[model samples]
Target: MLTEVNLAFNNLQGSIPSSIGHCQNLLAMSLSHNNLSGPIPPQAFELPSLSIFLDLKSNYLTGGLPLTVEKLKNLGAFRVSRNRLSGLLPNNLGSCVRLEALFLEGNLFEGPIPSSLSSLRGLVALDVSDNNLSGEVPEFLVSFGALKYLNLSFNDFEGVIPSEGVFKNKSATFVEGNNNLCGGIPELHLSRCNSKTSSDTSLKLKVAIIVVILGVTLVFSCLLILWFRKKKEQPTTTCAENSILQLSYQSILRATDGFSIQNLLGSGSFGSVYKGILEESGAIIAVKVLNLLNRGASRSFLAECEALRNIRHRNLVKVLTAISGVDYRGNDFKALVYEFMEYGSLEEWLHQSINRNESGIMRNLSFFQRVNVAIDVAYALEYLHHHCETTIIHCDLKPSNILLDQEMVGHISDFGLAKILSSDRLNYSTNQSSSIGLRGTIGYAPPEYAMGSELSTKGDVYSYGILLLEIFTGKRPTDNMFKEGLSIHNFVEAALPEQVIEITDPILLQERARQGTFTEFTLNDKHLQHLNSIFEIGLTCSAESPTERMDMSDVVSKLCSIRVKLLHPTRVYRERQALYIAQSAGIQ
Candidate 1:
């Protein structure tokens, strides 16, 4: 205790001793996963020699962040999330320019983000979500071009987000949780700038004038057509049986309890998702409310009800009801109700920082559990591809769309881009330009989809392979390092060839160490072998040619076999893992 201390995940209780300040030469201090209380000592905040990691997460610590944190000039990483801390962030936090990562989310902090944070030139990741912060988001922060991940969601930010420069270049992921935040990022398809803005009014007036001229030009023709069509047409004044009808708006409001932020489970281009209860039957549901007014997004909203009502499947997200009506302000609104998935999406469980620690939940998924999730997804995709009345291709197949039930079973959600294959048609796409132009999200879209070739069930196989990589490696597809050619594929390939220990996620490393799962060999040797097999599956699935990749059925068989052997302590699985490493390295 005098020189160094590393106590984590022991359920130890009580406040940290102020005497911890006396450990002058301490290189690293981890007091995580214990029941600690009280404000962090000011001395720990001002340690000049604390150059390495300082983790104090998952505790009962409270009160404002110590104002002295700016003095830790050499601190590289600082995390104090998932606590009861409150108050504004320190204005002097920018003094630590050497800081690379900062996580201060899941707290009770309030007040505006300080503009001073723009000085963190080397900052790579910044997350300040799940807080009570308010005010306009400062535009200068994105100027830190080195920033790869930025999340300022679940706050009270208001006003039109600045659209020019960095904001324009950022992805849809950069800004999703700010409810009052509208405009700026084009990918979100949020409302345009308010009409009061000069730029907005000018654009609106031009469009309005053009519409009026077109309307007048077609007026006589419209009247003549209407007279002839009236005899054959009937008005659609009555709502359908499954419709929420005029009470649609009220039912949604009641279910979601007025769309409370707590009920917000997730958000995407489609709209925000809220957990709610169907008042009529007292059943819980997940409601996806689309933002239709945004340009180009109106098509999805208009077609969602029609698409969901027509498509039926055991694995697809069940659409319970749909509501269409005009709000009090006469604004048109529509919402879709889905069966509430208690465990949330696979992506949320895998990647979301919410309720996670250094020892993440993904590591807790037993061998069987991991295999089960993969099999569940395979079954769903198999059904989507071959078992449907008309084959449906799920264009986007990322972890976020693969939801989980209370029992941890998997269900595929989000069908906005599904392509229905006609029985007589050999090709899947209806477009003349081929399926490439109709590609879904990047990374998951197959090579043929990029080549403008005819769509096939094999294309979905290619996507499932990429997804298998994500499931195995727990890495996102559009991750930045892959652009520099440091992807799971290259990393795994290189590691196997050299027997290097560079390819595995650090979480897996720590887990194996704690559990003594690699006692048969040195830590590096065991990790090298274990990850090599995982990466092999990823590589095989992500083969450039769709024909070379295994189908969902074969993939399920292989993964389940491996899972069974690993869980049951079969020597064959162990030897296979080692052999995979040796083969990858061309040593055996």
Candidate 2:
């Protein structure tokens, strides 16, 4: 009975039984994606022989990481993300010297990153994002040749993010949001140390000169000062904020042919989005015109403005300008002009009707394309959740909310439900009870929302979990489960306890190469296994309770690992594919 215990992504509750430490023969133990609480038992980390992987991520584990973790020298992988643990990282973590991947993100950990981590020469990936770590990032980490991926965003680290050596030009390092950090790559726009020193000296000299001049006082020429002031009268408007950036309403009407259906690309809860070309620039744009302009929508409108004003990520949709003015119809109107996305929403392409007959095949999403799209959204979320000055929670994250550009690149749009959590101070909404009623679409909302509790990043994780399930199964979360008639969560729960293959998408059984989506033209068992693992991961993410969902950073990493495995056409993948095809065809 003491085999590898991987009870991740289930509805299991309560603290881990301390008896688990007695599983002496256990090779890998993953208790991730559960609502398991209490400090991680010191015994779990002090296991003498368990080695392959130890992942306790996406749980409600609290208390600072047990110092006992340093004893697991043979541990190859360690992840403990999205917990409430705080305090400085244990300097002895480097004792797991052979560790290849280490994740401690989404915690309250503060203090300087231990310089001892530089000794993790074998480390390939490290994420300590969304913490309160301060002080200079150890210089040794930058030059530690083995480190391929590093994320230290959403922290209070001081000093410069050294751009020399391995850290140069690597976007993944993501050392943003540390206001005190300076003098990195030009992209960061941090002040150069030398310029700061020079500016300090210049400021002193200017102050001295001003003091000396003031000491020499001018004898009253009140009439002369009044004449100078009258000569220097200022203009009424600043000529910037009030300046009109959008075309006239008449021009927009002409471009859209009086709001014809032919010009409409899509419609959403707020408004109908139309595609149009600007008459002056001949530039194509997507315009979202407010439909009802209800009083309740005022908050959403302001939220969008705040989100747009602050964000500047490449993967995010850009708002060219917002048009709000009185029209000839006498009703005040408003619309947002955005850079057009030719492809449209991922939801439409995945599930919506395609042609007149309704027989048109769902646009086949390629493996590489899916991975790339996931990466794009992950990067955007990373920017919002970790790189921004305050953490942002994207409360609504359905596929319909994710749009694809002309290049088929994905961007997470619609920030109306975003909530900013500032780090400088703790603040909660007075309208907390009122906000409780604003739960997102039912199945996507986490258990906390269903129970009418305050919102948190965990709620977003729950939504993402459902999204992952939809992406892998090609089925909506509401789809009926066979016989048992349970929903997607129930189906995944029942299937995962048995095996991952039971819940895989049936369409994937076809020769993946024949599908013509992948650059390579083949599918095999290894790919099947990889898909199975990813499905299991999705199940883990969508666990009923928010506390059981994995952090987005860990989700991205696990998905990337599967993606890498898929790219490598091993014999295992081929054999699995052959077996899968044979089994589906009823071959003995």
Q: Give the number of the best model, judged by lDDT.
A: 2
lDDT for each residue of candidate 1 in 494-525, tens digit (9 for 90 to 100): 66645534554334434344665643333454
Cα RMSD, each candidate: 21.2, 11.5
Query: Please, what is the TM-score per model?
Result: 0.47, 0.53
Which stretches of candidate 1 lie above 4 Å from their native place? 1-247, 295-314, 352-364, 415-429, 432-438, 451-456, 497-502, 509-534, 568-588
Clash-forming residue pairs, model 1: 497-585
Residue 20 of model 1 has an lDDT of 74
Clashing pairs in 2: 9-540, 524-573, 524-577, 525-573, 525-576, 525-577, 526-572, 526-573
Model 1 residue 184 CA deviation in Å: 54
**Strongest candidate by TM-score:** 2
